[model samples]
Target: MTEVVIAGIGQTRVGEFWDLSLRSLGVRAIRAAIKDSGGLQPQALYAGNMLAANLSRQAHVGTLLADFSGLAGIEAEALEAAGASGAAALRQGYLAVASGLVDVALVVGVEKYTDLIGPGVEAALATTTDSDFEAIHGLTPAAQAALLMRRYQHEFGLPADGLAGFVLTAHANGAGNPNAMYRKAITLEAYQKAEMVSDPLNLFDLAPNADGAAALILTRRDRLPRDFPHPVVQVAASASVSDTLGLHNRPEPLWFAAAQASVEQALKKAGLSREQIDLFEYYDAYSIYAALSLEAAGFAARGQGWKLAAEGESGLQGKIPCATMGGLKARGNPGGATGVYQAVEATLQLRGQAGANQIPDARCALIQALGGPASTAVTHVLKRAD
Candidate 1:
């Protein structure tokens, strides 16, 4: 089996992009990635998108995106796994290259969520949960996350303001990222006083649904172009796992067992331990999700994740440096584009192109994506080839 390397990665500026069409956003990211990858045209392309049908009223997006990128005739496919769509596409591309089916591949994840207004977007996101059971109860994504947070607090004895630090940290980091959606640094007071989106989770605790795209060009380590500007970062492992569609079906409703399992498998395949990971790009659709994911990934004890945030241990200059890009909380969550954005940020860190957000001498990074409160989860580990 050949080792898969991320030859190049790119992402569009995240936030409300009322002007750019969905196709244009996808093309911009793809072109940037292709140019970054020494101008190596991909033999195949894969895209991850969600809510195109609801947001744009368009289907058969693969052809449209390929045509826009000037690779109309190339083999292109689109995938959807609710919120984990982007990571799922990247996992498929990694398998294709690792299995020697394709020497070079392009994977892109994009979403134009702002096309729909408030109610429309809410309705679209509701489809990710058990439509028949959960949706009937009018449980939005934030509501589900709130329920989980309530459970986590009850189970873990977490303080009412425990999650405030996480939100504040994300906002501070996001303020430094020019591409972030919410760049204003927040304070503990602001977090406590912020408008409540749900009971326990406030407005600032949730990621904004934005429009953006991200792209990654992958190839075998030995096949990279000679003029590649940075050291290769191998995709050492990738794993995806699913749980019951309904939140009530899980054995432990508060814990993300699927995410934990996926992360363990990915770490095993990478031949690395939790401590070996230098940084993490955790899915932060909500602050609670970030805490749960870190616990599931073995970075902290089941209930100790909030402590990591409170102590500034997960900041860019922290011990583990999780979500240096501000994660979805501040960076904006463009549905399908988030996982690819996470991978791209990790790649930038490894390539030493992360500007002020760079993690010093980062060699190994872990990225995880979860859909619908961990109904589906995917984890990937990347290592810089010395």
Candidate 2:
């Protein structure tokens, strides 16, 4: 198979961009990635979006973004796997380049949550879950997560504040990420007193919905300039695994079986154990997810994932630095654009461009994206070119 390298990366700050249209946000990232890649034009475009048709009332995002970016005739189409849309699109671009069918593949993850608000936004988000089984009964993502968190706590006999450390760590890390939406650190007391959004899922427990776009340019290593100025970052593994969509359908509701499988497959492809990962950009859309994902990725023992955060083992200088540029929690959940943001953030660390959030001597990075309670789990391992 041909090698796939991330030649360039770009992203807009994660926040409410009421002024920018969906395509406008995508164009900015596309242009920036192109410029970053030294003006390499893409032969294909894979747009990752979840709510263009639902919230923005626009479809054909791939062609719309391609035309807006002045690359109208490329092989363009949108790919969606709920929250994993961005990583799904990136995986497609990786495949296209890896198969030698496309020299340069452009993958863009864009979403404009501000286009709709209040009930509309809530309704749109609910679509990611099972409409008949989950959403039909008014179960939203936060509620779904709340149920999982409650079950996890009951099974593990955890305290009410068992997961506070993840929030603190994300906010503390976000303080160093200019692109993050919530850059200020919050005190433990602040988190404790924060109002609840969904039962046990407090305001601090869930990531706020936001608008943003992130892009990456993937090409064969041989196609890059002989003297590429930056350190080379290549896609070591791309693995996606899916499980039952409805929560009730699964025998184990909170296990994140798909995430575990995806991580295992990604690690196998990269020829490294989970311990070899320098940093992990996990699917921290919710606080409970960070805990569960650690276990699924083999970083922590089952039901003990929360202890890693409590013990500060997830800090920048600890066992496995995570969310180096802030995660969805502090970065603001950019709907479908999140997975691409993970890719961009992980690429930054691998290239030594993470600034204050940089992990010491970082080289290998593991990034995962979730699509509704791990129904669609996408995992990727990135490595600095030796």
Candidate 3:
């Protein structure tokens, strides 16, 4: 199989863009990605989207986005895996290039979530869960994550103020990120006193829904431009796994077995161990999710994730530098676009373009995306292709 490298990546400023339509957001990222790749256009395109059918009352997003971006006549396919849709689309593009089906491919993930007001948007996101069980029982994503947070806290003896550290760290990192939604540094007092959305999860604990898009251009390693501004970031491995849709049906709710499996597969495929990963960008839809993901991904042992966070060694300048870009907590969650942003950030770190958040000599990074209460997990390992 050919080695697939990330040629370029692009993302719009994540926030509530009430002015931009869904197609416009997609086009913005697509155009930026093409320009970032030195004007290289792909032979095919893959878009990762969730809730376009219900959010916009529209379908055929692949062709629509392709034509809107002035890439008509190219084979465009839509890949959906709930909130992990973006990573799934990138997986397809990786296979296309790795298997020699296409020399170059464009992958974009976008969602216009703000199109629907409060109840409407909530309803659309709930569709990512089990419609017959979880959703019907009024279990919002926050509520589900809250249950996990409670379990995690109880098992690990996490301090009541432990979650405040994650929020504070994310906000501090986000201050340097112009594209992040919440860039101001947050205080522990503010976070602790914030309005309660769920019992264990507060407003500061959840990632806000935003309208944005992100894109990446991938090509075979040998095809990379000689004069490119940055070194190519190779897609070392990509793995996706699914668990029981209903949280109660899973044998263990405290631990995410599917996420663990996906990470193990990805690390094995990359021929690397957790210790080799210089940085990590995992799903942080909620602060507790970050802890759970770190443990499941082998960054920390079970019931010790919050302890690791409390050690002041998990931020951008910390030992592992988890979510140096502020992540979903302060970076804002654009749903489908979130995973693509993770890949883009990893690529930037590998290329030494992450500015203030750049890790010193960072060579290897991991990107993990989770969907619907950890029911679906996708893990990708990327390394500098030097």
Query: Which candidate has the highest TM-score of all?
Result: 2
For candidate 2, lDDT tens digit of each residue in 1-386?
88899998999988988789999999999999998888888999998999999988999999999999999888999999989999999999999999999999999999999988889888889999999888999999989899999999999986899899899999999999999999999999999999999989999999888999999999999998676777889999999999999888999987999999999999999898877899999988899999999999999999999999989999888798887787998988998999999999998998899999988778899999999999999999999986
| Residue-by-residue lDDT tens digits, candidate 3, 1-386 | 79999987989999999899889999999999988988877989999888888898878888889999999999998888877888888898899999998988999999888778878878788888888888899888888888888887787787777877777888888887888998899888898889888888899989888888999999998888778887889999999999988788977797888899999999999999988999999888888988888889887888877766678678877877887888888888888878898999889899998998888889999998888777889999999979
Evaluate all candidate structures by whole-model CA lDDT and list the values in order: 0.89, 0.93, 0.87
Candidate 1, residues 46-159, lDDT tens digits: the string is 898988989999777777889999998888988889889999989989999999988999999999987889687898999998999998889888899999999989999989
Q: Estimate each model's TM-score.
A: 0.98, 0.99, 0.98
Candidate 3 Cα misplacement greater than 4 A, ranges: none
Ranking by TM-score: 2, 1, 3
What clash count goes with each model?
0, 0, 0
Clashing pairs in 2: none
lDDT of model number 1: 0.89
lDDT of 1 at 267: 96
Best by lDDT: 2
Cα error, candidate 3, residue 114 (Å): 1.3
